[model samples]
Target: MTRSINEVRVVGLGKVGELVALLLSDSGFTVTAYDARTRSDLPFACKELDVRDGAALRSALTGADAVVSCLPYHLNLGVAEAAHDLGVHYFDLTEDVPTTNRVLELAGSGEARNVYAPQCGLAPGLIGIVGSWLAKQFDEIRSIELKVGALPRHPAGLLGYAFNWSAEGVVNEYLNDCEVLRSGRRQMVPAMTEQERVVIGGIELEASLTSGGLGTMCETYEGRVQRLDYKTMRYPGHFELMRFFFDELGLRDRRELAGEILVQAKPPVDDDVVYLHAAVEGHADATGERAYRKQYVRAYQPLTINGRHWRAISWTTAASAAAVVELVADGRLPQTGFIKQEDISFVDLLSTKNGALFGDLGKV
Candidate 1:
């Protein structure tokens, strides 16, 4: 018999981590929060323990059914290693491709007794699920294009954006190579190179290549789809400005300094919006000879949860990880091994309490 997950340990107390802990607790899970610094203001049980300390991390993860790492992308491997040693399931919101590969290697080594799920965030997480759902609707897939962005509701400054999430993450995405499937072949493209314009909800924005947003969808649909790609959406003129910093100023080589500049110059905004669009074009199953295109567009804003306001990025990213964790706990997902975002159905994700924020599943 497969045991159900009841006790969860969430590592990190940042914006998204705090919400993950609260949401899991509200969903009837025993939640233990851990971080490097003391956080007495959190409403749940939290401990001050550095994840770098293997003994401390192992101790904190004691008896945990699952451990969710909300730490930065680079810091997730340690927690994942500890979780594997403790025979506990592990999940993280990392967008780093190399880090995900390392996690996959760990999951495939036969040493892990539980599942290892990585890149379980907004773009790579929910976006991949939505894209896979759309692709399945067709008899033969021809093209799949995914676009997602988190932008300030009220734009300011020359960049026309603000930091709604991690500055380092944003910079990293802009600097890394993006994977896409073209003509049924996997290809790697330079980030921020393919700039296109799109309009959603009457608002104009630009979409460009971004890294780690596609998750494992490229490999999943490599031979099945003729054209498949994922891009990040931003306000008009944003991509050009980023190109200046990354190319003209040569900030791509100095990513740390670039991150610092972005963090210092771009103030974090509470009022923000998350935009998601997944367009699939192919022959419908009902009419295999006819060509059809299906597109899903959604815009999410900040909401108050449990009497406290949270940013759109915070809740979206946190909700994605939380929903997946819940699904694993309920036996809706595989009990062991590495899991891909496409492995879970969009319907199952929408059925969760946290995933309901994506809106009604009937429309899909």
Candidate 2:
């Protein structure tokens, strides 16, 4: 019988990655954290390992049961390939579609040696699970809409934003084409379009179509759901300014330089809010309530962990990733083969040690 995951190697020690390591350690997993820069004072074992070096990366994963790639999306493919070659369970928080495709190719079909689960963070991670769980509550589902945003609570200038996360990731999402299920068919739509007003908790904000937030949901619910889309909510007028900056100024091609400038201007903030809003429209049952909608919406605020305060985005994303790993380690999830976010049980996800940070799954 395959042994449950107990030893984990976490690559990259950024804000979110560091938190993932902390959570896993607190949950009783022997964690080894790695990063390019040497750091000290962390509770768990921390090392400076160059993930770009394939030989060193594999050597580092020598005895680990699982590896979580906290590296950027561009670097995740190589890490995943190394994990597959070593038969170590692989997990990542990548939203890049092409990267995910390559990872899927690495892990074949059912009955694999180890697990390969990616896109296990905030929007594509938690949101996907929530949407799927809500869909299960209905007999026939028509639509599944997911929207999320991480922004500064206070409004500022025209952009009204802060670089709470990766600027490169943000730029990619803004420029890349999004996959959505429209009219019961998978369709590719341009990002930053489909602007609409969204009111959550009576705070009027705007939502625009964003890429990668939907993950593989478009393919999973292609023919079954009439409409399936994911959007990023922001303060009203934020999308318009972004369009002018990226399109009107022709900074789309210069993504790296654009990200640098944006981060310089709107650095990161301590007080940030993560908003998650998911709704499923369908029939409650065959005979009762032919048409109905169920929604899960909440505004996540900063939380204190281990006597230290963590930003909302950091804790939410980190907790989601750690929870997924916890489930896999606890044998609550599939022990092998690829796992889809939508296939993960939302109730179980919330019940996990780290996932408890997401709060209760609530009534469907």
Candidate 3:
């Protein structure tokens, strides 16, 4: 039987981390927030501790039922290891493929006593869940496309974009190779290529190849689908500006410098919108002769929760992870194992209080 989770330690108190800690606390879980550089303005209990310090992390997680790592993608493996050692459930919002592989390795080991769930964020997390649910609706899946973007509600500047989430994460996805299934075979494709124009919510946008957004869908639908890919949506001209920097300026080779430059140039905006779009096409039923298409599209904005305003990205990312954690606590998910975002049922996820914030039930 799954044990009740009453306490949780949240690592990294950044924009998304702060919201995660606050939302978990609001949901009746005792939250202890930690960060390398602690903030005094956070709403819940917080402490100063570097997650790299294994001893300190274990200590912080001592009596907690779970530890949620909202740290940068590169800094999550150490926390996952610490969680394994302490026998506490491990969760993270990392989109880094290598880091997730390491977490998978840790969870697969016989010594692990708790669950390990990575990529529990916006794109790789909720997007994957919705994609998997749509795929299951078809009898012979032909193709699946997933696209998501956290864009400023009122875009400004030359790029027509603002840093809604992690600047480093944005750069990483642009530079890394994206995995996709083409013609019923899995393959790796260069990022920022295959640009296409799309329209969502009466707004025209552009999308292109990006890494880590597919999560495990490519593997899950490997031989089942003829085509499967995930892309990042952006306003028109955004892709050209990024290409000028990554290709023309040769900043792709210097990723850290690129990230620094981008962060320094673009200011983070609180008034942002999280846009999600997914479509699946295949045979509708056993007839295997009819083709049908199903799609999901929604735009989420900032919300007032408990007298405090939270950005769309902040709440969407944090709520995705928190909802999964709640599912585990309620014994709806496996108590001790490696959990994938695609393993979650869409109805179950949307039923959670935090997940319901997306609004419009049965619309998608």
Candidate 4:
């Protein structure tokens, strides 16, 4: 049985971790904020510890009931391993499929005392839950499309893009092979292919196949849907710029260097928008004449947390991660196993303190 109030420790004090700690604290959990960097504004017990240091990580999680990771994808495995050994629940915001698979393997060790959940952020996180919610409404689901983006409200650069989140995660997705299910068959699609333009809120935006956005949806919907795909939304010219860099310039082979270049050139922005779009199409009636469609559109602006206002991208990502941890602490989730963001029920998610962030965003 899950306890009433969990003592939560957050690793990473970046944009995502800051909001995660804030939201968890606000939700009545005993929150502790841990980071190598110093942030005077954050609430709860604040400590300086590097999660990459396995010894330090275990020490930091000593008495904590749960650990929520807001670090980049590369740093997740160590923390997950430590969580598994320490018998504490683990959660993270990662879109890396391989990293997620590793976490799942670790979670399945059967010796863990608590749950291990990854991909608890925007696309893989919220989109998975939204897709699962729609799947339940249809009997013969045929197709599912998910489009999500963290974009700048105001344009400044040639790409019209902003670095509101992790540069490493973004670069990895751009370079890696994307997974998609076509006609009930799983295959690899080159990243940055299948470019298209979409208008959201009367604003014209571009979208295309990006790696890792689908999370475990491809496997979850493999046999159920004839077609399943996921894409990342960006400004009109972003895809063109990326194609030139990854394909023409051959930066795909040098992802680290490419990420360094982008970070040095294009930094994060404060005024940004987080947009999530999901649609599931299938038959509703037994006659096979009725078509059913369910869509979820959630948008978030810059918000304040722990008395520190952060970008919308940070808040959304961090808040989403925090919500997963809150659920596990409340015993709403599995205690010892691999947990996907889709495993979360939409109804249960939106009702929580941090989950309420999606309440104001109307249904699409």
Q: RMSD of each candidate?
A: 1.9, 2.1, 1.9, 2.0
Task: List, residue by residue over 244-348, the lDDT tens digit for candidate 2.
Answer: 999899999999999999999999999998889999998986548879999899888888899999999999999999999988988889988889999999899
Which segments of candidate 1 are over 4 A away from where they belong? 1-3, 287-289, 360-364
- Name the best candidate (by lDDT): 2
Q: What is the alpha-carbon lDDT for the whole of candidate 3? A: 0.87
- Between 1 and 3, whose TM-score is larger? 1
Clashes of each: 0, 0, 0, 2
lDDT values of the candidates? 0.89, 0.90, 0.87, 0.81
lDDT of 1 at 360: 48
lDDT by residue (1-364, candidate 4, tens digit) is 5464478888887767777887888878898888887567655788888777889889988888788887778888888888888888888888988889999888777666778888898878988888888778788998888889898889787888877677788987776789998898788988888888887778788888889988888887777788888889988889889889877998778878888888778788788888788888889875456777777776678876556678878777777777777677777877778887777988888877888877754343
TM-score of each: 0.97, 0.97, 0.96, 0.94
- lDDT digits (tens) for residues 8-85 of candidate 1: 999998979999999999988889999888788878898899888899999999899999999989899999999888
What global local distance difference test value does model 2 have? 0.90
How far is 11's C-alpha from truth in model 4 (Å)? 0.6
List the candidate numbers ranked by lDDT, top first: 2, 1, 3, 4
